[model samples]
Target: MTKELLTGNTAVALGARLSGVEYVPAYPITPQTEIIERLSRWANEGAMDARVVTMESEHSMLTAAGAASVAGVRTFTATSSQGLLYGFEMLYNIAGWRAPLVLANVSRGVASPITLEPDHNDVLSARDSGFLQIHAETCQEALDSVIMAYRIAEDDKVRLPAMVNLDGFYLSYTREPVDVPEQERVAEFLPPYRPQSGYMSAKNPMSVAVVVLDGRAYSYFKYQMHLASTNALAVHEKVAGEFEKAFGRKYPAVEGYMLEDADYAIVITNSLTTTARAAVQEMRKEGKKAGLVRIRLVRPFPRQQVADMLAGKKGVAVFDQNISVGSGGILYPEILSALYHRSDRPKKVVSFIGGLGGKRVGHTEFRHMVAVTEGCVRDDSQLASVLLFTDSDWQAVKGMLRTAGKGEVSQ
Candidate 1:
């Protein structure tokens, strides 16, 4: 293995290359196009043994990817926010078809109000679409998760598609040191893709499209998909173990930092978790019993692990990067639900939404969250979702409103 400075996009490409991907069906989009560009260059130069096909649209790109995977070959593909939305329909198809392929999603904030920054909305939109999710907090995790995703997804007990997500501009473009494992070592960790039994091939030709005439039949298949997804939890733990033994890096479903004896906890995910980590350290130095829990494996949502981490805390704040519109932060209630049944559940649970459209989430916002959670716990009162909007953010918005000839709006 050799250490090299690499961007998250380049790391993903190297991971795919080292994993021996046989095909890549691609559609170019900001942040994500760099990954495909590198792969295409390598494939063209004969440096990587793979077929890189440029599809006309994200829809067709995913369709071709699923088709190739079902046809018994290792496949990969990537997309960003709008591009991922464009191909949303194929997400369910690929997962329902039980295609064991890998997709790298560079998370970008969605449209309606447009920006080229990072958020979890695009990927979270596919949460119930039957795809397993692995969120990365750094360029290194971005590379390692893609490699681990293949092993988890292709497991016989969990034959489902998996997505490896990283924040678009944050990790995607930022350069960092990465350990690129030797191909021989990687092969020992992840062998060639052996198509599952009944996969489409010349020697085992079979119909992949199955039609159900009754609701009962449909329910059975859907339940099987759920079971398969749940199976990924164990499969991920097993693969993560082997990965650690082989590479000396261990990734768990949920990672806790200084959480063992904390009085307060912050729950977050994706690249923003790095900033939260530093905030936790500062809080520790200030004599606050603060900690952080990062959700790494999002789907097959690691419920038991999360509950165990946040158990017995005095106050718990869930920081969500995406909002659910009328509801609130997407991850808030999910974490709440996870802890609801535990006897040692947190005394106070609060929600904070920030980092939308890749806006910077500094120590100020984290400190604010901690303060608010402390207040909520002291008063034993319920608090609605708090938006992490600062005075500067409001002033900028006011400027935009005035420029648009709109009357002043109250803060």
Candidate 2:
């Protein structure tokens, strides 16, 4: 193995190159464009034997990927917030075709009040698109997840497309040291894509469209996708084990830090997980008994795994970088629902939303989040009150405005 300092985008491109992805049809978008740019450069230099095409739109890019996959070729592509939404229609179609491929999603908040930063909403928006999803916390995880994405997606029981999501600016552009695994080991981990040698061929006389006018037929196909997705959870774990054996790295569905004996905990995902980890360390230093759990496999949601980790805890704070407007944090409700029916579930699960549009979630916010969760545990409050309670802590900004006011209201 060779260690090199690589940005998250470059790591993703390297992963795809190692996987020997033969087709990549991409469109440029902020943050994610670097991945395409790198791959295009490699293709041009003949360092990577791949066809990197710059398409007119993300939709066209996805369409090209689907077309290639249908013809039994390995395919890959990437996009960000707006670009992902632009190709929304094709996202559904590609998965329905059972065209197994990988799409790297550099997560960005959706538009309306547009910002060129990171959020989970863009990729989570495709939750029902029959795509397996794995989110990464570091540059290394970003590269490693890409490799696992292909392996899991190509499993016979889970033959569907997949998405590897990394926060746009946080993980994508940031540089870090990553162990570049030998190509021979990667080949052993992920063999050549030889599925449907005689079936998915263009030479085969078969129709692509499924004419389903009845609800039952549509449900049948959709349910099949669901089954495949549910099966992917197990498939992902198996692949992760093999990955660890091959590269000495572990990517659990949910990674726990100091949760075993903690009274309160925090649950998070993506790059913010590093911040949460730091917070947990500080909490430990102060003897507060706080902990964190980072969600890696999001699509299958890892319900059982999450429940097992959070069951014995007294209180838990869920920090989601994406807000669902009227609904609050997107991941907050999912965590609640997963543990709600469990007998050993945490007494309180508080929701805290921060870090939208690539906003920085600093040390103060982390401390505040833990404080709120601890308070909920102390007071025996419900989820509604916890939301109101956290929301009430607006003094951070109010105090700043108060200073600018200079002891007077704004004129």
Candidate 3:
């Protein structure tokens, strides 16, 4: 193993190459394109042995990779917000077919007004689509998660597609020192893909993409897919354990820092967790028992494990990069449901939203969010679920509107 400075996307590309992937069908999409671009360049330079095919659209890209996967070889692909949605139908179909393909989805918010930035909505919107998900907080995790993704996806009990998520500009573009494992060591960790049945071969011509006759049959098959996805929870833990032994790094389903006896904490994911951790340290300096629970595996939900982590805290704030339109923070509500029936559930929990559309969420935002959570605990009050706008956020918008009106009247 050797330490090298690499961007998240570059790390991901190397992760796939090192995983012994034989096929990659993909299209270029912002924040996600670099991954495919790197692989494409490597294959062209004769450094990587893989088939990198460029398709017309994300939909075709997913279709090609999905077909290649069930044909009995390892495959990979990637996309961001709009590209992910564009290939949405094929995602469900591939999962149902139980193809063990690995995909990297660099998170980005969906567009209406249109902006390029990172958010969980692009990923969370597909939470129930029968794919295992790992949200990485650092460039190292981004690389390791992609490697682990292949192991988990190809597991017999969890023969499904897997998605490894990283924040768009945040982790995607940021450089960090990552431990690049040797290909020999990675080979020892990840086994070759060999499915039970339905492989593409002239000697064994098996029917592919057969039609299901009735709703009852479809429901039963879908339930089977659900069971396979849930099986990933245990599979992930096992893979993560072996990964550490192989690479000398540890990655759990949920990473809890200073949560053992904390009275308050923050539940967050991806790159922002770094800032939250620093914020917790500052709070600690001030004699506050603040901590952080960083989510690693989001799908399969890890509900029981997460509940165990947050149950005894006096209060906790949820940091979400994605909004659920009329509802609230997508992760916050799900977390509430997880802890609701627990005897030791926290008395107060609040949601704080920021970092959408590539907005910077730094120390100032972290301080504000932590303050709100602590105040909620002290007052024993329930706060509204969304924190979309602060007094200052609104004031700035109002100031812009005033300037626009003045210019219109002067004209």
Best candidate according to TM-score: 1
Question: Model 1: which residue pairs collide?
Answer: none
In model 3, what lDDT does residue 76 have? 94
Off by over 4 Å in 1: 202-205, 404-411
- Cα lDDT of model 2 by residue, 300-353, tens digit: 788889989999898888888877777888888899889989999998898887
TM-score, each model? 0.97, 0.93, 0.95
Give the higher-lDDT candidate: 2 or 3: 3
Rank by TM-score, descending?
1, 3, 2
The Cα error of candidate 1 at residue 27, in Å, is: 0.4
lDDT of 1 by residue, 158-262 (tens): 989999999998999999999999999999889888877777867877775677786898898889999999999999999999999999999999999999888
Q: What TM-score quantifies how close candidate 2 is to the native fold?
A: 0.93
* True lDDT of residue 307, candidate 2: 88
Candidate 2: residue 221 lDDT (0-100): 89
Worst lDDT 10-window in candidate 2: 384-393
Order of candidates by lDDT, top first? 1, 3, 2
* Evaluation by lDDT, superior candidate among 1 and 2: 1
Clashes of 1: 0
